[model samples]
Target: MRFLLVEDNAELGDAVVAWLSMEGHAVDHALTLAEAHDWLAVAEYDLMLLDVMLPDGDGRSFLRETRTAERLPVIVLTARSQVADRVDTLDLGADDYLTKPFDFAELEARCRAVLRRRGTPAPVVIPLGSALFDPSSGTLTQDGESQRLRNRELRLLEVFARNKGQILSKSHLLDRLFSQDAEVTENAIEVYVGRLRRRLQQAGVQIETVRGVGYRMTAP
Candidate 1:
């Protein structure tokens, strides 16, 4: 999953980004509404973590305007713990609200809940031939055995499994796989794809390279 985290606090923003990224989700952190707008203009994000008090403007107003423009799922992260504030934000179309100084684990749960409610929720476990791939934990199970995959490999597997049989361009895969790393090259993706292909081959899955265009995944 890809997330656009809109917050201004350096400490909090850094912590959230690190936490989400470690969980195998691609995250782009925007420190202000202007930066958020720029990110929104360029990339399609699965969720937005918006801070109510930004350096540039009120996040509530931004949420209102954003609702009019797109169907992006937003979870407001704010210090305002008032019941009225929560109700008002919900009325404005926020999918969820998290007050400041909250638990990171809780935030992660809320994010998953909001995504499941707002978007096409992925299966809890996707069957790939003889294996079962769990998106939530990035684990692949086969023959009643399961093992958690490395972060990048898990992300690549999830992306491929979600869009099975569709040809994904290198540029598109690059954006999804290496959103936070500007230094990663297309060659890096090839390495990851090669590794994932080897793993999936045992499960009766194939990752096909489309010559000059991109790659496609098919499961038997």
Candidate 2:
């Protein structure tokens, strides 16, 4: 998934970004509220990890603005663990809360759960004929055998599963998969789609290709 990390502490920000990236998530880091706002104005993010105290402004204000215009999912990470603080943040539309000096594993789990809750109505354990697609681990399994996916493959499958029956155009897929990157050609999308298709087929899933539109995942 694509994530925005709004944190001011340089060391902490770098560590979080690296950890999330290693877990197959595309992460963009912003050190201040201004930078976060600028990025939010142009790009789309699956989830945001925000720090309450920012250098330029309070993250709560930013969260409020996002709530007014869009339904962006945010997880407030701050040192203040007071009940009032949590209630205020949740009232302002934060989906989850994590206090400072927390475990990174817990943060990762929360991120996955938040994004999955916002996704399409696919089962937590996706069943495709005899195969099962586990979103949590990004793994495909069949007859008790399983294999993990690469970052790009996992991302491509996540998009497909989220928009199950929709015909996603190549441009749209590229935009979601390679956000803020250089222009990606349709060929690149095709190649990745081909790879994902083969993997899914091995696990007994079916992905349909529309003549001139795009691709869609159909029930087995």
Candidate 3:
């Protein structure tokens, strides 16, 4: 997932960005409303984490102005806990609101829920023979049992499952598995693919090497 975090507080901004990155998300952060707008103009984001207060402008005004202009999902971060404030923000098109001093875990959960609502209509539970893959939770189950996987391996598996039977090159896998700024080598992909192939054997899934090409996934 790609996210835009618009927060003036450096500490909070850094914390959120780090947490999201650890969860396999690409985050672009801005400290002001103008900077946030610039990001929105150039690149599309899966989600936006906007603050109610900005040095240059009110975040609510920004939300109101661009709500109809784009289909981006937004979750408002504000200290305002009053019913009127919440109602007004919601009316102005905020998808979810989090007050100050909120739990980081709760924030993560809300962000995920908002994304689930805005994300593609594709099914979360993908079946591979007797295996069940939930991209949302990053879990795989085989024959009613859960299997452990490294985060990168799980993400790589999801890419293959989404594009099952299509040859996926090392470069394409690297792009999908890591953020634009992530330092990862093409050789790293080979390791993950190999690990996944061995682990997936019992699930009746196969990751076939395409000679000089790449890899493909099959469930039979």
Winner by TM-score: 1
Over 31-149, each residue of candidate 3 has an lDDT whose tens digit, in order, gives 99999888778766777889999999999999988797987889999999999999999999999999997787898889878877876544389988778888767778887788766
Q: Of the candidates numbered 1 and 3, which has the greater lDDT value?
A: 1
lDDT of 1: 0.89
For model 2, the stretches where C-alpha displacement exceeds 4 angstroms are 115-123, 179-188, 202-214, 218-220
lDDT of 1 by residue, 28-76 (tens): 9899999999999999988999999999999999999999999999999
Question: lDDT (0-100) at residue 210 of candidate 1?
Answer: 96
Model 3 clash pairs are: none
Clashes of 1: 0
The residue-by-residue lDDT of candidate 2 on 1-220, one tens digit each, is 7788999999998899878767767678899998898888888888999999998999999999888988778899999989999999999899999999888999988886786677724337767667777876789888789989887787788778767778888877876766454455789888888887888776556778887888888765
Model 3 misplacement above 4 A: 119-124, 143-145, 166-177, 185-191, 202-204, 207-216
Q: What is the lDDT of residue 50 in candidate 3?
A: 91
What are the models' TM-scores?
0.95, 0.78, 0.78
